[model samples]
Target: MTDHATTFRRLHQEGLLLLANAWDAGSARLIESVGAKAIATTSAGLAWSNGYADGDTLPVERLYAAVESIARAIRVPLTVDAESGYSDDPAAVGATIARLGALGAVGINLEDGDGTPEALCAKLDAIKRACAQAGVDLFVNVRTDIYLRGLAPEGERVGATLARARLYRDAGADGLFVPGITQRTDIADVVAGTSLPVNVLAYPGLPAAAELAQLGVRRLSAGSGLSQTLFARAAELARGFFRDGDSAPLSAGAMPYPEINALFAQR
Candidate 1:
């Protein structure tokens, strides 16, 4: 666990760490097999996979079970997208994160969505204390929804994000995740303003990986994009099967049964 924690933290020191977020054990193992340096969970994907909606609606116990399954399935470091820590009380949130860390998660993405920066700071402080008490080393990647939620005007977005970043960093954040930020100048400004590694979500207008690296971006996340695509494809396949009972489309581009079975079999 210490080796994984150290490696997960070192991945952000230089270059762009591309995180193809996974939702389940199967997805996580497949991602690791493809050479992913680390596995980060997508809260949206995980919720949807478990028959729940995205946001803070999913139960924390369910999240713990999911994290445990993913951790057992993959050898690389695991990071969870614990949306708002699933509670308003800082202590409860901190305890939840500590449990995840104990379940083999080396990092977590905690966001401030439609919430005050001070609230997130309190949570971060509580998390730090809780992790210390539990002898857990967790990389708390603080996420600000200024850009994602349109919390600021076009010109002031960068400044607002940086302001939140500073608060989070002071409160013991290891990285800063700014979703929905796409412009090069805005990305660079946020990166330069804070000492924490800057993480950006994959958006339509986001720059290429090489360009993002040159602009000092440290991490790029696919968020729920891959899961959304898979959901759409599943819907299409179901519709086609229900309409014509054709089995061919279902197997199109599908991984062979043996290959998929091999993943769980090895475990």
Candidate 2:
């Protein structure tokens, strides 16, 4: 666990760490097989895969089970997205993170969503304490939704994000994630404003990987984009099968069965 935790932390020190986020054990293993340095879960994808909606709606126990399964499936470091930590109480959130650590997650993405910075800080503090007591090491990536949720007025979003970044950094964050800021100037400003590794989500207007690295961005995540696309594709295939009973479209562009089976067969 210590080794995995250290490796996960070191991946953020330089360059842009591209995370093709996964939602389940199969997705995680496939990602690792494709040379991903680390695996980060997409909360929305994971929730939807388990028949639940995104946000803080999934049961904590289900979250734990999912993390454990992914951890066991992949050899690389695993980071789970605990959306709002699944509770408002800092202690409960902290305990939830600690349990994830015990299940082999080396890092976590904890978002502030519509909550206050002070609330996130309290949760970070509690997480630090809980992990220490439980002898677990975790990289707490603090996510501020200032840009994602339009928490600030135009032109002042950068300042608001930096302010929250400072608070989260002081409260023991290892990285700062600003999910919805896409402009080159805004991205550069946020990176320059904070010392923590800056993570940006994959969006339509976001810069390419090389440009992001040049701007000092440390990590880029796919979020739920891949899953959403897969959902759409599945729906299309199902519709075709139901309408014309054509089996050809279902196998088109599909991964070979043996190749996918080999992934799980290794374990």
Candidate 3:
């Protein structure tokens, strides 16, 4: 049996694991071309990238299909963003993650969000037990959204995050993810507080890869930021082509036709 979780954990330990979130095969191949070590699915990016709303609007079948496409496209370990597991029941969600393992997935981003902390921890525990029972080394990327939800008042973001992180870690989470954190001091503080490797969202000019590496950041997820940037650029290019008729800046004699042709291949 392939040790998918084992393979993924090594990536976290060795260096900065830049997980390029790909909603389809083309993005996976493109990230592979640029030498990304692993590929991850973005729940928001996948839905929005494919013209659906965020959250469970995409459905489990469609999201699972996206993961299959990406897993087939790249050899690197794949981590899926199974948003809230799309269900309230933890056992059912754990079943979903285990099913993903059957499809060659090594890791998953599970969030303890959308409810109270105690409720979220129970869900996390359920998934961990399921992973262990399956004999799969599942790298559970636990996302703590205290800051993301604007609940970290009194500059207590670090303390709040630590509380969540400690709970998840003790509950058997593989990593702690805290997005929307903007301060370097807080970044260091959070990293200091948790024995688990910290994962932060990418921000402009906040910290370089080296700076984050020094702070003991094991993983750096682009979250939905990459998809947002891509769409923004695409919107700009669309306007140019609409008015200029094939004289757009994006059509600057690049994007090989063969690579584009390869996107729609049957699986």
Candidate 4:
């Protein structure tokens, strides 16, 4: 395995890998400056930044450009959120992952939204093959939306997730990301059900980091929460500026231009 891949995989076995998702190169470099272990891209955040909605609506080339930009802007390992692989065909998804690997992405988030387990398994198999061909030890974190999309009842959610986790692991997934799961009991059950590293999305009701580690979660991602919060704050700032014609609100908590420019100068 490459050093980047090794570092990323080892993180899952050690402490909690906290990922603050970035939507653009500037956001990525800023996050990396804060001592993040790795950089993750949120599909929704990227899409919104590019004036496109999520759900695979962003052009494939645009996604590639964004990933490449972020990869070039940071020193740490990058993990692209390639939602649903951006294609239904297994080979196509594999090719996309291989290209991402070539662009310095050591990991990817592939989801099984409404697809069948078998189809996701097939896609995973193809991804493994592509990674092998490229000699990239890409960490594929398979995401199941049983709870996020309301695919199963509250009582059946854990069971449904476990079944998909087994299939995905068999298909060579390195980790299992169960988003929208915050309860301690449910998190513990999913962690115990799988040997693969468990990744959870950070939400309002989610337990603290210490508590999550105790429950055996290896990674916690902010998903699109950071971007959503940022834009919302930006909107408020704009509203205040327009109403009162004051620069005070816009200047608060803003990074100095010199420091912001230094991030790119060091590159």
TM-score of structure candidate 2: 0.99
**What are the models' TM-scores?**
0.99, 0.99, 0.91, 0.97
lDDT of each: 0.95, 0.95, 0.79, 0.93
lDDT of 3 by residue, 205-254 (tens): 55887888888888888777778888898898898789887764876766
Model 1 lDDT per residue over 1-267, tens place: 999999999999969999999999989999998899999999999999999999999999999999999999999999999999999999999999999999999999999999999999999999999999999999999999999999999999999999998899999999999999998999989989999999999999999999999999999999999899999999999999999999999888999999888978858
TM-score of 3: 0.91
Question: lDDT by residue for model 4 over 93-132, one digit each (tens)?
Answer: 9999999998889999999999898999999999999888
Write the number of the candidate with greater TM-score, choosing between 3 and 4. Answer: 4
- Across residues 117-178, which tens digit of lDDT does each residue of candidate 2 receive? 99999999999999999999999998999999999997999999999999999999999999
